[model samples]
Target: MKKILLAVLVLLTFIGTSCDKVDDLLTFYINQEETITIESTFPIGVVTPLSPIPVKTNSSETFKNNKTRAELVKDVSLNKLTLTIADPADENFDFLRSIEIYLSNDKGEETRIAYLDEVPKGVKAIELKSTNAKLDKYIKGETYTVKTRAAIAKPITRDVAIKAAMRFKVTADPI
Candidate 1:
């Protein structure tokens, strides 16, 4: 009886220690979500080709807690994207056809991130949410650029305002 009890105590100790190690391995240090919005005006009487629109620049402050770009690329993920037409009710709303978003670096390289082809008429907002596990090779120091294409069924005499909102989640090792 003494031998059996001693063996059981040893097994329990080993199991407990193994579980603790697993917990340590599974621990995550930092998890956060961030949202950014970019807006531009589609000028009247001008059909803008596929070109870069104004978007927020990535600053050192973007990577808080002394995080490195390598760490951010490993941990960052795009969660949701939303596009809104601030003047959807305007007379020229139907002329606005589609918008494409791209990730661009200072080197002039670009990667298309999101595309909205057939925007529902009269709708003010559209959400392009995704369940994808990772961003498409997003690197640090990259900024977002928007390309808008419009097909005018009729001529537009006024400008239209457009906005995009991007939401993402990031997990990193705590500083």
Candidate 2:
């Protein structure tokens, strides 16, 4: 009976020692950090051409042998007009601001008949660095001429911002 008790005590002591050693080797892992980044891109604008307008012609009256006669004719033609704006190619994204536009005549002189104080109601404004802008407008023999040009009026720019996202991962043994 003494021998049996001694054997049981030895077995219990062995198990206790093994459990303590396993606890000492166990460990835990953790991760803590953040990253930041910036990204940028330019915005583009588009414009469509306007349809042609027809003009009506009037006739002069003639009298012969106490009789008067008059005649009139209808004239139609396609008005080819195009509106163009230069791309702002200034330093890294400086064209994000504003753009100025101007109108000039065929003699290389500026014209007041065709003028734009700001972007027109239906026209879209694009952001790009450039020196000249050309546009097409209908002429009724008064407001605009056959050869008119559009140019840059003032340099415009605006501030822009961009951001990027990232993720982190971790793996470790538990204590």
Candidate 3:
């Protein structure tokens, strides 16, 4: 009878240990949802979103620049577009994964100005929720229109948006 009791005790212990191990494994499989947040800065003398600036896009309604549906602004010096991104809800995001900036020229051509590794003259790019970068090259007084959007590598349906804060600093410069 004692031997049988010992065997039952061992079996109960084994079941308890097995259950604990399974619980741990289940906890490991659970994952938390991730998110990202990007912020921009509009300086004291900067132009702001008085209204919804229309985004120019192609025939498919994808964000692009061309004659029709082209995003535009007055000609401002390169010194005026100071901005930054900060306070990402998730720090694990690939911040530098894919980003692009475009400059519109006199001929109404869209010029690719900057990307992940590059920031245009007077433009600054930094990571953090509340950081600031200045575009000293864009003179304050000049007027310029710009189009900016973030590029996501995953799929076209994904909404990857960034605020293109353009502030034409008031200065005595010509466009």
**Which structure among the candidates has the greatest TM-score?**
1
1-175: candidate 1 lDDT, tens digit per residue: 9999999999999999997675444332322222222224435344445445645545345554344434533455556677665553543235555555555555566655565665566666776534344542342444545444443333455555555676655444433
User: Largest lDDT belongs to which candidate?
Assistant: 1
Candidate 1 vs 3: which has more TM-score = 1
Please tell me which model should have the higher TM-score, number 2 or number 3.
Answer: 3
The lDDT values for all models are: 0.50, 0.26, 0.32
lDDT of residue 92 for candidate 1 = 29
Clashes of 3: 25
When sorted by TM-score, best at the front, the candidate numbers are 1, 3, 2
Q: Rank the candidates by lDDT, best first.
A: 1, 3, 2
Error of 3 at 61 (Å): 32
Which RMSD does model 1 reach against the true structure? 8.2
Off by over 4 Å in 3: 1-76, 80-88, 91-95, 105-107, 112-114, 118-145, 149-158, 173-175
User: Which of the predicted structures, 1 or 3, would earn the higher lDDT when compared with the native?
Assistant: 1
